[model samples]
Target: MTFLHTIGAIFIFAPFLAFIMFVLLSRKKLKRRSIGFSADLTTFLLFISVPVSVESLWGLEISFAVAVTAILIAIFLLVIEWKKSKEIEVLKYIRKTWRLYFLLLSVSYILIWATGLALTVISFA
Candidate 1:
Protein backbone atom coordinates (compact mmCIF):
# COMPACT_ATOMS: atom_id res chain seq x y z
CA MET A 1 0.00 0.00 0.00
CA THR A 2 1.11 3.52 -0.67
CA PHE A 3 1.77 5.93 2.15
CA LEU A 4 0.50 9.48 2.34
CA HIS A 5 3.98 10.86 2.86
CA THR A 6 5.17 9.33 -0.38
CA ILE A 7 2.43 11.08 -2.27
CA GLY A 8 2.99 14.33 -0.43
CA ALA A 9 6.70 14.31 -1.18
CA ILE A 10 5.98 13.92 -4.87
CA PHE A 11 3.52 16.76 -4.69
CA ILE A 12 6.14 19.06 -3.18
CA PHE A 13 9.42 18.01 -4.74
CA ALA A 14 8.75 17.14 -8.36
CA PRO A 15 9.29 20.64 -9.80
CA PHE A 16 12.67 21.31 -8.26
CA LEU A 17 13.96 17.84 -9.07
CA ALA A 18 12.82 18.14 -12.65
CA PHE A 19 14.66 21.46 -12.98
CA ILE A 20 17.87 19.96 -11.64
CA MET A 21 17.59 17.04 -14.01
CA PHE A 22 17.05 19.37 -16.91
CA VAL A 23 20.04 21.50 -15.96
CA LEU A 24 22.27 18.46 -15.67
CA LEU A 25 21.06 16.93 -18.89
CA SER A 26 21.40 20.21 -20.73
CA ARG A 27 24.92 20.67 -19.45
CA LYS A 28 24.23 24.23 -18.25
CA LYS A 29 23.12 25.33 -21.68
CA LEU A 30 19.63 25.73 -20.28
CA LYS A 31 18.94 27.63 -17.12
CA ARG A 32 16.11 26.93 -14.72
CA ARG A 33 13.89 29.74 -13.50
CA SER A 34 10.38 30.52 -12.32
CA ILE A 35 7.89 32.99 -13.72
CA GLY A 36 6.77 34.31 -10.35
CA PHE A 37 4.75 33.50 -7.27
CA SER A 38 1.38 33.70 -8.90
CA ALA A 39 -1.22 31.81 -10.90
CA ASP A 40 1.15 29.14 -12.15
CA LEU A 41 2.15 28.32 -8.62
CA THR A 42 -1.46 28.40 -7.54
CA THR A 43 -2.25 25.85 -10.20
CA PHE A 44 0.57 23.58 -9.13
CA LEU A 45 -0.29 23.88 -5.46
CA LEU A 46 -3.91 23.19 -6.17
CA PHE A 47 -3.01 20.25 -8.35
CA ILE A 48 -0.97 18.73 -5.59
CA SER A 49 -3.58 19.49 -2.98
CA VAL A 50 -6.47 18.01 -4.95
CA PRO A 51 -6.08 14.47 -3.78
CA VAL A 52 -6.01 15.40 -0.16
CA SER A 53 -8.78 17.90 -0.57
CA VAL A 54 -11.06 15.46 -2.38
CA GLU A 55 -10.43 12.70 0.11
CA SER A 56 -11.37 15.13 2.84
CA LEU A 57 -14.29 16.72 1.09
CA TRP A 58 -15.87 13.98 -1.03
CA GLY A 59 -14.15 10.68 -0.46
CA LEU A 60 -12.71 10.67 -3.98
CA GLU A 61 -9.70 8.71 -5.11
CA ILE A 62 -6.39 10.51 -5.59
CA SER A 63 -6.35 10.15 -9.37
CA PHE A 64 -9.84 11.50 -9.79
CA ALA A 65 -9.11 14.34 -7.45
CA VAL A 66 -6.00 15.29 -9.36
CA ALA A 67 -7.87 15.28 -12.68
CA VAL A 68 -10.64 17.51 -11.46
CA THR A 69 -8.24 19.82 -9.75
CA ALA A 70 -6.17 20.17 -12.89
CA ILE A 71 -9.21 21.08 -14.94
CA LEU A 72 -10.30 23.65 -12.42
CA ILE A 73 -6.82 25.14 -12.21
CA ALA A 74 -6.48 25.47 -15.97
CA ILE A 75 -9.80 27.19 -16.29
CA PHE A 76 -8.99 29.54 -13.47
CA LEU A 77 -5.59 30.49 -14.82
CA LEU A 78 -6.86 31.11 -18.32
CA VAL A 79 -9.73 33.22 -17.12
CA ILE A 80 -7.60 35.26 -14.77
CA GLU A 81 -4.91 35.93 -17.31
CA TRP A 82 -7.40 36.89 -19.97
CA LYS A 83 -9.21 39.23 -17.66
CA LYS A 84 -6.24 40.93 -16.03
CA SER A 85 -3.69 41.27 -18.77
CA LYS A 86 -4.39 43.51 -21.75
CA GLU A 87 -0.94 44.53 -22.88
CA ILE A 88 0.57 42.64 -25.77
CA GLU A 89 3.99 42.83 -24.21
CA VAL A 90 2.84 41.08 -21.05
CA LEU A 91 1.27 38.33 -23.08
CA LYS A 92 4.46 37.98 -25.06
CA TYR A 93 6.46 37.67 -21.89
CA ILE A 94 4.14 34.99 -20.66
CA ARG A 95 4.52 33.04 -23.85
CA LYS A 96 8.28 33.26 -23.73
CA THR A 97 8.55 32.36 -20.05
CA TRP A 98 6.15 29.49 -20.19
CA ARG A 99 8.89 27.08 -21.12
CA LEU A 100 10.75 27.48 -17.86
CA TYR A 101 7.56 27.51 -15.86
CA PHE A 102 6.43 24.31 -17.47
CA LEU A 103 9.84 22.74 -17.19
CA LEU A 104 10.00 23.35 -13.45
CA LEU A 105 6.53 21.97 -13.03
CA SER A 106 7.39 18.82 -14.94
CA VAL A 107 10.52 18.38 -12.90
CA SER A 108 8.59 18.59 -9.66
CA TYR A 109 6.02 16.10 -10.82
CA ILE A 110 8.63 13.59 -11.88
CA LEU A 111 10.53 13.96 -8.65
CA ILE A 112 7.43 13.25 -6.66
CA TRP A 113 6.66 10.15 -8.68
CA ALA A 114 10.18 8.83 -8.44
CA THR A 115 10.27 9.41 -4.72
CA GLY A 116 7.02 7.58 -4.24
CA LEU A 117 8.25 4.67 -6.31
CA ALA A 118 11.47 4.48 -4.39
CA LEU A 119 9.61 4.55 -1.14
CA THR A 120 7.34 1.79 -2.29
CA VAL A 121 10.24 -0.38 -3.31
CA ILE A 122 12.12 0.20 -0.11
CA SER A 123 9.06 -0.53 1.94
CA PHE A 124 8.49 -3.77 0.17
CA ALA A 125 12.08 -4.85 0.62
Candidate 2:
Protein backbone atom coordinates (compact mmCIF):
# COMPACT_ATOMS: atom_id res chain seq x y z
CA MET A 1 0.00 0.00 0.00
CA THR A 2 2.76 2.44 0.85
CA PHE A 3 4.66 1.45 -2.28
CA LEU A 4 1.62 2.12 -4.41
CA HIS A 5 1.10 5.51 -2.80
CA THR A 6 4.70 6.44 -3.53
CA ILE A 7 4.26 5.52 -7.19
CA GLY A 8 0.97 7.37 -7.32
CA ALA A 9 2.63 10.50 -6.02
CA ILE A 10 5.33 10.24 -8.68
CA PHE A 11 2.96 9.59 -11.59
CA ILE A 12 0.49 12.22 -10.48
CA PHE A 13 3.04 14.73 -11.73
CA ALA A 14 3.76 12.78 -14.88
CA PRO A 15 4.70 15.68 -17.09
CA PHE A 16 7.80 16.27 -15.01
CA LEU A 17 8.48 12.56 -14.89
CA ALA A 18 8.11 12.27 -18.64
CA PHE A 19 10.32 15.26 -19.29
CA ILE A 20 13.09 13.96 -17.05
CA MET A 21 12.94 10.53 -18.64
CA PHE A 22 13.01 11.99 -22.11
CA VAL A 23 16.00 14.15 -21.34
CA LEU A 24 18.00 11.34 -19.80
CA LEU A 25 17.10 8.89 -22.55
CA SER A 26 17.99 11.36 -25.26
CA ARG A 27 21.25 12.33 -23.62
CA LYS A 28 22.34 8.74 -23.15
CA LYS A 29 21.39 7.54 -26.63
CA LEU A 30 21.26 10.45 -29.04
CA LYS A 31 23.47 13.50 -29.26
CA ARG A 32 20.65 15.66 -30.56
CA ARG A 33 17.09 15.70 -29.24
CA SER A 34 14.49 14.44 -31.67
CA ILE A 35 11.19 16.25 -31.33
CA GLY A 36 9.25 13.40 -32.93
CA PHE A 37 10.66 10.77 -30.62
CA SER A 38 10.13 12.99 -27.59
CA ALA A 39 6.51 13.57 -28.46
CA ASP A 40 5.80 9.88 -28.99
CA LEU A 41 7.49 8.85 -25.76
CA THR A 42 5.76 11.59 -23.79
CA THR A 43 2.41 10.53 -25.22
CA PHE A 44 2.97 6.96 -24.09
CA LEU A 45 3.84 8.12 -20.57
CA LEU A 46 0.78 10.40 -20.47
CA PHE A 47 -1.45 7.49 -21.46
CA ILE A 48 -0.15 5.48 -18.51
CA SER A 49 -0.23 8.41 -16.13
CA VAL A 50 -3.78 9.54 -16.89
CA PRO A 51 -5.56 6.62 -15.26
CA VAL A 52 -3.09 6.37 -12.39
CA SER A 53 -3.40 10.07 -11.64
CA VAL A 54 -7.18 10.01 -11.87
CA GLU A 55 -7.41 7.09 -9.49
CA SER A 56 -4.99 8.72 -7.09
CA LEU A 57 -6.86 12.01 -7.21
CA TRP A 58 -10.41 10.85 -6.52
CA GLY A 59 -10.04 7.17 -5.72
CA LEU A 60 -11.96 6.49 -8.92
CA GLU A 61 -10.61 4.14 -11.55
CA ILE A 62 -11.07 5.81 -14.89
CA SER A 63 -9.14 3.52 -17.20
CA PHE A 64 -12.36 3.30 -19.16
CA ALA A 65 -12.36 7.04 -19.70
CA VAL A 66 -8.83 6.89 -21.07
CA ALA A 67 -9.68 4.07 -23.44
CA VAL A 68 -12.85 5.75 -24.66
CA THR A 69 -11.05 9.03 -25.15
CA ALA A 70 -8.38 7.35 -27.29
CA ILE A 71 -10.96 5.62 -29.45
CA LEU A 72 -12.97 8.80 -29.86
CA ILE A 73 -9.93 10.85 -30.78
CA ALA A 74 -8.89 8.28 -33.36
CA ILE A 75 -12.38 8.24 -34.85
CA PHE A 76 -12.55 12.03 -34.92
CA LEU A 77 -9.21 12.27 -36.71
CA LEU A 78 -10.20 9.62 -39.22
CA VAL A 79 -13.43 11.40 -39.99
CA ILE A 80 -11.65 14.68 -40.64
CA GLU A 81 -9.10 13.00 -42.91
CA TRP A 82 -11.78 11.11 -44.79
CA LYS A 83 -13.71 14.31 -45.35
CA LYS A 84 -10.70 16.18 -46.67
CA SER A 85 -9.30 13.49 -48.97
CA LYS A 86 -12.12 10.97 -49.22
CA GLU A 87 -9.52 8.37 -48.28
CA ILE A 88 -7.41 7.44 -45.31
CA GLU A 89 -3.66 7.77 -45.14
CA VAL A 90 -2.72 5.13 -42.63
CA LEU A 91 0.54 6.66 -41.47
CA LYS A 92 -0.76 10.19 -41.39
CA TYR A 93 -3.89 9.16 -39.58
CA ILE A 94 -1.97 7.35 -36.88
CA ARG A 95 0.36 10.29 -36.31
CA LYS A 96 -2.49 12.74 -36.11
CA THR A 97 -4.44 10.55 -33.72
CA TRP A 98 -1.48 10.11 -31.38
CA ARG A 99 -0.69 13.83 -31.40
CA LEU A 100 -4.30 14.67 -30.67
CA TYR A 101 -4.27 12.29 -27.74
CA PHE A 102 -1.13 13.93 -26.42
CA LEU A 103 -2.75 17.33 -26.67
CA LEU A 104 -5.94 16.34 -24.87
CA LEU A 105 -4.28 14.20 -22.23
CA SER A 106 -1.71 16.84 -21.33
CA VAL A 107 -4.48 19.36 -20.74
CA SER A 108 -6.51 16.82 -18.80
CA TYR A 109 -3.55 15.83 -16.64
CA ILE A 110 -2.97 19.44 -15.58
CA LEU A 111 -6.65 20.02 -14.89
CA ILE A 112 -6.84 16.89 -12.79
CA TRP A 113 -3.97 18.04 -10.57
CA ALA A 114 -5.42 21.50 -10.24
CA THR A 115 -8.79 20.13 -9.21
CA GLY A 116 -7.15 17.75 -6.75
CA LEU A 117 -5.23 20.60 -5.16
CA ALA A 118 -8.33 22.74 -4.97
CA LEU A 119 -10.28 19.99 -3.31
CA THR A 120 -7.54 19.43 -0.74
CA VAL A 121 -7.32 23.13 0.02
CA ILE A 122 -11.05 23.47 0.40
CA SER A 123 -11.26 20.48 2.68
CA PHE A 124 -8.58 21.84 4.97
CA ALA A 125 -10.28 25.21 5.14
RMSD of each: 10.3, 3.4
TM-score of 2: 0.76
User: What are the runs in model 2 whose C-alpha is more than 4 Å off?
Assistant: 1-13, 23-33
Cα lDDT tens digits for candidate 1, 44-80: 5545543444454446577664566445655665666
- The model with the greatest lDDT is 2
Error of 1 at 91 (Å): 8.1
Q: Model 2, range 39-118, lDDT digits (tens) per residue?
A: 67788778878788888878899888899878987888788898999878899889878878878888888888889889
Maximum-TM-score candidate: 2
Q: What is the C-alpha lDDT of each candidate?
A: 0.51, 0.78
